[model samples]
Target: MTVRPLNSVFIGGRQIGANCLRVLVDMDAPPQLVIPDPDDVGVDSWFESLVKVAKELSLPTLRGARVKDESAIKKIRALKPDIIFCIGSMQLIPKEVLAIPPLGVVNIHPALLPKYRGRYSTAHAIFNGEKETGATLHFMDERIDSGPIIMQEAFPIGNEDTARVVYDKFTEVGTALFKRFVESLKRGEEIASTPQDESKATYYPKGLPSGGKMDPSWDEVTKKRFVLAMTFPPFPMPDID
Candidate 1:
């Protein structure tokens, strides 16, 4: 059987990098090369995990990279991949890199997007007391997650669900949805996607306030919501003086 070609994958960020890598390998839809980001916490570890898997299949270690800024783009251009899959990595692809891929670039964001187009989507969902959240696979544009949606997999945000739990579920559903999407492509199926509603779109800047004063005077429901949102570990419980 002829394996489908997926070109190169630019992976980093938290679980997005590892989960995408895992699914690609599992579905045999892995790219010709992988651009790893060691700067991201545990990203290199994800690469190492895949390295072992690659060796077992008699494949070379996926390309390892640590450079940043223009130098990194130059190196990527030199590699000449036909498609670029962005899993994470804060670096944005310029027009020069986008031109190299006929398929353009595809990325997966951990929110129902068109809603959460920027950073801290998971935490935002918890903070806002959302009852539903999801992950989106879409084309990459100069704007954030404002691209056309290739697919989206949604999961319930239980009243008790923590941000960490929601994040994990996003990866779980995202990987499964991504596999189906890629398989359809390999079978010569045309992709059908609807443009995101710009009117409903929202963007979150990085370092959005994760913690604030936790007032004991607040109602029980509001206090619980605050705890749910801030308990994700990175945002410490507000210091009570």
Candidate 2:
């Protein structure tokens, strides 16, 4: 008997998003609809474009539709997907959108949830001198990165590793985790997840730190770590004086 692929709507952007989408296609379980980040165009030159990847694969795409918006929600609801996979986009998935998919909205976050629960997890991890950081696949709730985690895998952060390096590591580990999740669905295994410990949670606000300025008051080691955390090519390094 032939098994039917899961019906899914993909909401993603950036390199990791594109990579995850490719993984789905490779596994013969591509999403029914693709929603690339609205602001992704011309946002950055360094990362792969989800829009481009979707178009290249001839997958149906809806660009410029924010999930929080009623119109986008309606469009997604019409598809009647079993699940919604959201990755890489920083926009918060509202409860309205979250309720559309029966199985829940799955999100791939770059850091271990309840720890680095914000936009700049990799950078924050490096800046804080964390020896290891990891990726998380979780269900999306109203709060940012606060949902129960489906899967997580940690990897070491080297002393010489910068934010860019760690980010690549996240992409690798996170994408693999997502692929595993898809494979599980193919095998008809029930999803398993665990609620995060709120006491261990941490959050960082959106946008660059101190407007991307290096604090002169920081000691040599701190300054160095800060700079390392902020380093990514095709984007200017943090200003140091």
Candidate 3:
């Protein structure tokens, strides 16, 4: 059967977002509109530019726009996208925009949902001494990362893995999930999703307060994990008290 192309919109930023967007484009499933995080949100040296890649692909790009804003909602509504993909965007997509897409807004999260449900997943997972961490793809709801899960796969976390290492693993698994998702859509298959278990859900707020400072009373092992978890290259490790 010939598959019908999906009318899609993409809201993303960062290296992972750039990579996932390329997957869509390379598969001939590029979105109708690309909404990248504004310069202020994604301009850091650590991240690749989603906007630049969108432009290079000749995709219609929108920047400096928040999905919660009415103006932005109007633009998205006008497109009447069949599906909206939100990958690597830190903002929680509002319900108004979520209601716009018939197939629902899909999100690719760096950590397994219902466990690490926020921005600092890898760091928190590493600091908590988790033996494994993984990525998830889900249909977004009004709440943050508390959506119906489409897919999840876990990878073991090595004893010496830092936040950056776990994050690179997340990127690998997350982008692979994106590839599978797009391929399914290309084949015109109806994706199945399971609602997340609310009881298992946990959230981590953005940023590490006190600069991820280790508590002086923490055990040496705990302190060591904290240091590793907070370590991401191009940024120095948190100062030990």
What is the C-alpha lDDT profile of model 1 across 1-241, one tens digit per residue? 4445666645444566566666667776766665555443322342234444444444433344543456666767777776677775555666666676677788888899899888878877777778999989998877778889999888999999877778778878887777787777666566677899999998888754344556778778767776776666554666633
In model 1, pairs of residues that clash are none
Reference-based lDDT, each prediction: 0.69, 0.87, 0.87
Can you give the TM-score per candidate against the true fold? 0.81, 0.94, 0.94
Residue clash pairs of candidate 3:
none
* Cα-based lDDT at residue 234, candidate 2: 67
Evaluation by lDDT, superior candidate among 1 and 3: 3
For model 1, the run of ten residues with the poorest summed lDDT: 40-49
Q: RMSDs, each prediction?
A: 3.5, 1.8, 1.7
Q: Per-residue alpha-carbon lDDT of model 2 for 6-34, expressed as tens digits?
A: 99999998688989999999989989999
Task: Give candidate 2 misplaced runs (Cα > 4 Å).
Answer: 1-4, 42-44, 207-211
Clashes of each: 0, 0, 0
The 10-residue segment of model 3 with minimum total lDDT is 38-47
